[model samples]
Target: MSVDDGAVAIIGWDPSLVRETVARGLRPVLVRDVPAHLRGTSIPLPEETEEIVVEDITDVGDVWAGLTRHFGERLHQELRGIVTFDEFAVSTVAALTSLMNLPGSRLERAVLMRDKHLQKQAVLAAGVPAAASRLVVPGSERIRTPFPGPCVVKPVAGGGTAHTEMVRTEAEYEALLNKLALSATSPFVVEDLVDVAQEWIVDGVMQDGVVVFSSVGRYAAPCLSYTTDAEPLHIYRVDGTGEDERCAEARAFAGKALQALGYTDGVFHLELLLDRSSDTFFFGEVAARVGGCLIQEAVLLKHDFSLAGGAVDVALGRPVQSTSETTDRCVATTSLHLPRGTVVRLPNSGRFAAADDIHEVRVAVLLGVNDHPEVRATTNWQGLALVSAASLAELDARMAAVRGEFIEQSLVAPTFGTGVQQRAFLADYEDAWRRLL
Candidate 1:
């Protein structure tokens, strides 16, 4: 049945995806609060409309209680199923798996998938090549590694590269370890850095513990910079099912990893580093939900598949369609990650309206005068542009031109009353905005 006829509940962090799901016809009862403007953009409720609930899902307890309340009683009373795109859902779903009297393996497996340390252990035990990793628990700084160099450090349970640190030397590594506040006992993983030949992404749905539909992605830019940058940038490879050996190996490894993790049902997003130097595929990470960035959109446009919708179907024990034959003629997405401390303003966005390939320009960051954070300090994404190119080369050229024309011209020195007062001013401003919002 079409989503219009069926309602699904979405529990995830990314509000944008929640908005997109509702736009696609599935009545999304968001488990997270919707921004005011986004609420304004939502489709108006019909006279006989299906109810859509939006709640604050800042923690795991909130999610568990929310799901049980919705699925246990709400589903039977109204046709509904749970769909999620955030890591927190893994734990919530795991908890619900037992209480709901459903298959618990998928949820248990997802915990292993979401936890980098657990995932690495499972895959390594299966004989898959992976970077030597250590789960830096609280007060556990004396961790040793055989090949520690240019080690990668990332939060044990965060995505989008937030809080991810790269230590290239002994000094940097030691500093990072010291500053990590190992006393907190929070989980962080440090892994040996590998000279990556190519960055790739693979995703698909599994049915009854077997692979059904899958595709691989090639990143146009490096993962290191992609994770830690603001300003419109493109990082995409190709998404196709062709007779390429490299693609085959990457796909095979993805399938193997999913099976090894015992992920019986649901969407799996896997990242791998192809070491052409050794002709070996190294597991980077995996998410039980859809891949972050534009991969979710890319998957839909390139493969005519909806992992989100399929996931809901699987959770409801409904039938799912195969996505192997879907393909996008051409698609590209760029994160309009403007530089911090660059006091810039949005021009007549309609000026770029005539651009042939540029389909949509979304400003995630609002237009306002605020102190930009320092370099390496994380801020919310400024904006994103989804362009539809006629060809790959055209996509690249158009994105580069757009970046050059807009980001450069828009770059302006941030106004500063005084250097020392900047932090205090920013703090006040942030507090005001929070209170106002």
Candidate 2:
């Protein structure tokens, strides 16, 4: 079948991605939630979109019914593949692809990636090194950790470190459980925390169970640290050919882990924890979609290719060109977060954008004077920036400068009453500015 003969169903609303897919010769069929698509964004759909079907993207049965009702008999002939950029819709897209007999990640593989326990079991069974973990069901008898020392507890099926915590003693564990119980996010996974010196993220594209393109990035700080710490999260790309030992090792490990998980096609985001003392790497987790934040933009800037476009190609069963040839330039993506308080001033984005190294400046939240920022236990950022430099040291300096400037110009006043929570917030707010200098 030719690329122009059938359409690919994209399960989220991204106008720019739709335009990119259209430019590659495949028609796009959008699938979105009725309430979210109508209320979420003000941007209109692209003219290249063939058709859009609205349903609860979280409900696989509703989405299946909606797709069937819209296409009827043409579902088989018109639909080439099903894909999604949203983490919540990964399993839904996988199920639909299986039902439609289209090309995409299998349902079982998707399930393994979605559930933390299952993912660890699959990888360990295949002789991959990973942290030992066990499942925790709500209302069940309290289970002790298999390994001693500090352990991490988090939702069995979630991302972005929301509600993830590290507990050392029984009192802390009990407190965490009570906190989680009130929130109703249960079925947690408790794993022994690795003595990690640094964390690395591997973003790549796979075709027919083989890796085609891969890149390695070193995180300045672990993503989990951002939830309580004041440091900005930065990921600087490792530049060089496959001969670079660290980059090669990370890429190889990522490929082996993805293969063990039964991921055959599409883009993948994998994380690995490094123990510098022993020169060992531990499997953190993997996702079936593009890495969140500015990962896609970083890949495009360094590799001169589009991961979004690659996902569209893989979904449509088109041959993917290898991204082995890179610009050999240093690029990094930084996410800046604000303390929980009322906004007194906003940062000057134009000043950051004027720098030669700065490629893009994105402000997610627009807070005016006296507006309280949204509070959450996650790595949600208020703004993001993309920068490129000639060397790693230069990249770090530029990132530090940008981060320092943003915090200095933006002022947030504490609105919460005097309490432990308010005191902690104020401490983080002050420390964030102090560390920048």
Per-model TM-score on C-alpha atoms: 0.78, 0.86
Q: lDDT per prediction?
A: 0.64, 0.78
RMSD to true structure for each model, in Å: 6.5, 5.8
Residue-level lDDT of model 2, residues 44-66, one tens digit each, is 65566765556677688877777
Misplaced by over 4 Å in model 1 are: 1-7, 13-27, 33-60, 67-79, 102-105, 138-147, 182-185, 227-233, 240-243, 323-328, 342-344, 347-356, 369-380, 405-413, 416-437
TM-score of 1: 0.78
Q: How many residue pairs clash in each candidate?
A: 11, 0
RMSD of 2: 5.8
Best by TM-score: 2
Model 2 misplaced stretches (Cα beyond 4 Å): 1-5, 40-45, 50-55, 142-148, 241-243, 344-352, 368-378, 407-414, 417-437
In angstroms, the error of model 1 at 222 is: 2.5
